[model samples]
Structures are given as C-alpha cells and as structure tokens.
Target: MPETSLPVFIAPPLRLPVRTIGRRTFDFSRQVAVMAVVNRTPDSFFDQGRTFALDAAVQAAVDAAEAGADWVDIGGVPFAPGPELSAADELDRVLPVVQALAAVSDVVISVDTFRPEVAAAVIEAGAGVVNDTTGLHDPRLADVVADSGATLVVTHSLAAPRRPHPRPHYDDVAREVADLLARRVDVALAHGVREDQIIVDPGHDLNKTTVHTLELTRRLGEVTALGHPVLAAVSNKDFVGESLDRAKPDRLAGSLAAAVASVFLGARIVRMHDARAAVDAARMVEAILGWRRPVHAVHNVS
Candidate 1:
C-alpha cells in the first residue's frame, strides 16, 4: 500500500462579519478589538487583586474604556489551580462591579466564569458576554448564554475547575485546539447559541507548555479557519514569561509581541492587561494590514 500526502490547509478569510456584544456591534472583518482584563479576584495572575475592591474594579473598567478598550473582561475567580470559590462568593465579587460598570460605561462587559449561575447572574447584571476559560466544561453554561442572548467565548483547555494539567501532550497543538473549539462551537450551536454570538480561544497556557503556546500562536490561522472570530488572551501569561526567560512584570514586551502576532494571524479580539498598549498595537497591525486607516496622513505626502 502506498501512502498519500495531503497538502497543508490554507485558511479562507474569516467569515465573522459582525459581532454584537452587549449593545456594541463590531465589524470583525475591519476592526480588531482590545478587551481589557479586569480581575475582581484577589489572586489573579497579573494584577494580583489590584482591582479586587469594588471601587477599584469599577474604576479600572472605566479607565480601560477611556483608554480605547473596546471591551472589558471582568473575572471574579482566578483560573490557576486554587481553592474552590463558592458560587455566591463569585457572584458577590462580580455582580456589583458588572452593575456599576454597566451603569457608568457602554464598553462591552464580559464575565470570565464557567459557572452557569454566575454567567446568568452577570448577564442579568448587564454583562454582554460570558467567557468560559474552562472550555465549556459544563454544557449548562452554553444554555445560560443562549437563554440570555449574550455572546459566548469558549476557550479550549484540558482541565477541570481549579485543577491543573501541569504537563499536557498533544500530537498537534494547534490542530487539536482547533478541533476542540470546533466541537465546542457545535455544542453551543446545538444548545441554541447563535453562530454569530460564538467566539473561540485556543486557551494559551491554560493547559499548555511554553512550546505548545508558541506553536499555537504561530498557527493561529488554523483556529480562525473555523469561521469564528478568535480571541487571544496572551497577556502576561506564563508561556510568555518562560519563552523570554523573564518574570511576570517584565513580560509585557513579550505579551505585546504575541498579541500583535496573534492579531496579524487573524485573531479578532485580544484580551490584555495593558489596555492602552494593546489597543495601540492592535490598531497598528490593523493599519498595516489595511484593515484600518491611519488617523493622520500628513507625514510626508506631497
């Protein structure tokens, strides 16, 4: 028997034209959005609870919106392996902040939680998106997003709640992640979540090693090929730290590089801790790729 070799797949242009999160509608084909990360948890990896206080969280959201962030992703619990947080505690942590931000700003609000109850509560509290970093471990979460008519960001991770897969092995990291996200998208669609409301994330560092995350970034178009707007949350992650041999605070440069690379590779939304920097980088990439026009065109034109 002779073996046949297939050609490598080249992705078509992303078909996600319009994404309506909360009351804001984005033309994904033309605009790349910077989603500011607002962690209301005391143990989040980046800010380390800087915005854990209600006032601080609200102010951070407002500040990010003012700084050009298109969306603000608020999280009540850290995704790192940690002690279990009660659902009520999680609700208390994020609901007030979501309520306050919804009242003050029109930035698309997203709550990073995998709990259906938390997703429902936050949507009722004015959140327009539910970002499940757990890869939709609970199918009920999809139901909640569907019922609320909120957008859903499904990430691919091979871990349960508060559990760690320290060493993960995948034959093809990007391909496997894309396949997983495709399945998740199918589940969401079957559960009544509209196709246009779904966004996919490859879950960088969630259950991957540094090399795996790098490979995923390099081949991000494979994930975007699924016809959904891809979201990359590579802000100050451990993979960036390990790749650059730098500490958490020093990985901003690496994070920015990865974010820009992801956007160039067709990621529509970038989740970042530094909203202003990320917004600048994303806009620069968009402009270079002709997706966006320069603000001022008077440099050297005759």
Candidate 2:
C-alpha cells in the first residue's frame, strides 16, 4: 500500500481593520500595531511626571514614533491610586501633546481618559481614538465618540461606589467581566457607536489579581469570541511584574512575552510600551505560525 502525505494545517493570517483615532483606517492584518504609552501626570506608576514639560512630552511622542510605535496613547492622570483629574485639567495636560503629535506625525494619537469633555477636546485637537478605562460608564461618552467619529477602546472594570469604599468583588472573574463587557457593548450601541469603531480590552491589571490576569490571558479567545477586536494591554503592569519578580522598568521582557502569548490566543491589537520589540516579536510569530492572508490570493497560503 502506498502511503499518502497528510495535509498540513496552516491557519489564515488574522487581519483586523481598526479605524484609529487618526481618522484613518489601518490594517492590523499586515502587522501588530504598537501603542506607546505617554503619561502626562505626576503620578503614573512607571513614568509619572516624566513628561511634565511640553518639550519632554512632544519628545516622548516623537520618540515613540521613532521607536516604531504605530500609535501614541497620551493620558493626563495616573491610573493608580490617585485623584482623577478634572476634564478641563486633563484637557490642558494632554491636548498640547496631542496637538504636537498631530502636527508632526501622522501616527494615531489616542487619548486615555473616560471624561467625555476631555475626549471631545483631544479629538478636536486631532486625537483619533478614545481609550476609556472606564467601560462606557458616562452615557454621554458614547455621544462624544459618535460626534467625533473616533474609535473607542472600551475596557472592563468593576463599578466603583459613589462614596469612598473598599475594592469591589467578582466571584467568577472571567464570566463576570465578559458579562459586563457584553452590557457595555449594548450600552455603546444604544448610544449610537458603530460596531466597527469599537474595541474591547479585558482590563488586564485593573481590578484584577495576578491569578485573574493569568486566567483572562488564557481565556482571551473567549473575550475575542464576543465579536469585537481585542486590545491586550500587558505593558509593565503590576501582575506581569509581580509574576516575574521584576521591577516595573525590568518588566519589558515579561510584558513582551505576555503580549506575544495574548496575541497568539486571539488578540488583534496589542497596546504596549516597547513598540519595536513587541511589533517585531508579533511579526515573527505571525511568520512562524504562517498567520497571514496571501496578498495575491486567499487560497494560496493554505
């Protein structure tokens, strides 16, 4: 009997179209876009007050672009334990950087804040995407997105009480987060945000322990299965640092590993700090796994 050659299984390269804060469309199928972090606050965990000066801020954005970041995410306040900056204050802190970046480069300028006023102001200044750490809480936020025609990254987080309170709870973290995200999508839809303009991040370090973060990473396929592109933000996060026994600055390698793993598990966009390293690693993974659609023909790769 003659032995027949078994057919090799090659998954098609996953291509996602993200309409960015730049008001232009990018093809993620071509490469994993790197999002450089630019914190304008005095208390951001890693680079707090690192760019208080406008020159420093502009330089940071320029450096991110030079370092191979496909986009630059500028935030006014620290996400850690601190007082949230007011909308006007936030606008003042970040709009200059956004305007500067928009003037110099065509790179995507993402404003990381939940305040609708701030989001509107920054987008008006030429920022493209609204990365809301608060998962669609302010109903008015949806209106801002619709009005500005900017893409939205709606990440998951537990609802906080009005009064100062203790940490929230999640009995089944994955299911609860997924449910909350599903509701968030419904909320956005109700408020007039288009489906294609939405991105869902499972809120990697926020309101989650190391075990929870690990579980979410393993189940990212489940999150992406919800029918929206996934943005995995595993850059220098507490869980990654704590898991690897490394300091914040030393967490780049760990973050890169986590980003690679998350993308392999079904993340479409990776929000990261080390843009060049992350983008190169993701491209290599895509190459090694043969995860790309043939440009000339769809059936050619298979």
Candidate 3:
C-alpha cells in the first residue's frame, strides 16, 4: 500500500427512531424510507400544477407507490408566502386525493399541511401522517395529530405559514436548527403527542439561504442526534440547484447527492420529488451501510 493523503471518513452511529404509521412500524436506523411528494398546487415550484388536478394527483401518488416509494406526501398549497388559501380550499384540493389514494393503497399517506383543520380532515380521510413544515407553530396541529393518533413531522421554519421570512439570520445555523427542532419536539410531547409518533426536519430552503442550508446539511448529524428520526426534504430544493448551478429540472444529480449525504449524516427519511430514483438511491445506501442485503448476490456466486 502506498502512502495516502486522502481523508478517511467514517459514518457516525445513527440513533434511528421507530414509528408505526398505518399499522406498519418502520425502523429508521435499519431501513431508509422515501416519502414521495405529490403537490396538488398550481404554483408548485417543481411541477407547477402538473399534479394539481384531482385525477392527476391521485395518479401521481399511485405512480410513486409503484415506483418503490415507502409512502406519498400530498400537499394542497405551496409553503411559500403566496396568496392565502382558505382551509376549505386547501381541503378541496387535498381531501379527494387522500380519500382516493387511501382507499386503494397501503403505502402510508402523509399530508403536508400546517393548518389544524386541514390536518384533522386529512387524518380522517385516511392520512397516517401529518408533514407539518411549520415546526408546530399552531400547536393545535400537534393536538390534531395527537387526537387522531397520527404521525407528526416537526419541521423547522422561523416564519408562519404563507409568511415571508425576510433576511433570515442564525448565529450558528446547524445548532439553531437543532435547538429549534428539539424545542418543537418538546412541544409535541407536551401536547400529548407520543414520542414514537414524531419526526424532525431541518426545513432546508424554507426560510434558509443557500449557505445556511449547506451548513445545515453538513451538520445534519446534530439534528439526528436529537434521537428523533430526522427527515430531509432536499429534493430539487433551491440549495441543491444553486449549489450545482443547475436549474430545477437539472438538479436530479445534486438532489440525489444531497439525499445520500443526508443518509450518510443520519437522516432516516428522505422526502423527494423523484420517487423512483430516490428509492433506488436510498436502497443503494442501505445496502452499502449493511443495513440491507443485496437482492441477489449473483455477481460472484454465479
């Protein structure tokens, strides 16, 4: 062996969280899960109403499941501070998809919403998890999840839903994100939510600059160290786009790299727009970590 100058990187031990959704329990440390995004909003940055129609949203969720996604995340509105959409309008866009998909698929149905009413309705419409990107701003959202016995994803965002977080600041972005997530997890517990039912996300690009998101991604282990399964929604995000100087449609490679990086740093669940590719990528990581075995070891065995 020749003298080496390359740095050796060792992955840290992951403290994964286990939770049961839709009567199925998932161990994050042992298995990587992909939550496919199906945004039923016309202003969605990625697809821009491609799946906004009721039938299209339903078909998209089904397609994601067939593509090996562990579940689907349905959203009615964009998180950006756009025009205010009433609860009824949000439900009209989301409920039909949830009802249609839940009636047919066992893949977990996760609804992305911060409003308590929307959360309640979706949970009733067969949603097993509420992907609240608001970091429990309402707290009533936690109540709805708790009351419905549904899983809750507490994502870190400084601003209220549909409100602009202008010129965001953080002394230490990673530390602050972790601290805020810890605080929000505590709030969920206080609101009668079960520990196993909670998940944390750093909310990349939601209210963060590209630099801040980069730091957070590099230091995601801190968030994972909180002992709740950390979810990274890095699919086609502006950070990935800006980091690689690629536009949204061209960010697949960056998105996979970021998603895999998050996995290396201890993220258990990856929310992605490209479900099939993400599922394949996640499984590859799982096999590399020895968390999952290869489907067939025929390369040498044969």
Query: Comparing 2 and 3 by lDDT, which wins?
Result: 3
lDDT, model 1 = 0.89
Score every model by TM-score.
Answer: 0.94, 0.87, 0.94
lDDT of all predictions: 0.89, 0.78, 0.89
Residue pairs that clash (backbone atoms under 3 angstroms), model 2: 13-291, 13-292, 21-128, 21-129, 22-128
Off by over 4 Å in 2: 1-23, 161-168, 291-302
In the predicted model 3, the residue pairs found to clash are none
TM-score of 1: 0.94
Clashing pairs counted in every model: 0, 5, 0
| lDDT by residue for model 1 (1-302), tens | 23333222322366666877898999887688899999998898888889999999999999999999999999999999999999999999999989988998899999999999999999998999999999889999999988888999999999998898877999999999999999989999999999888999999988999899999999998898898888999999999999889999899899999998887787889999999999999899767666667899998897
Per-residue lDDT tens digits for candidate 3, residues 1-302, read 23333222224344435677874678775688999999999999899889998999999999999998998999998999899999999999999999999888899999999899999988988999999888998999988888889999999999988999999999999999999899999999999998878888999898999999999999998888788888899999999989899988999999999999998887888999999999999999877767777898889775
Error of 2 at 147 (Å): 1.6
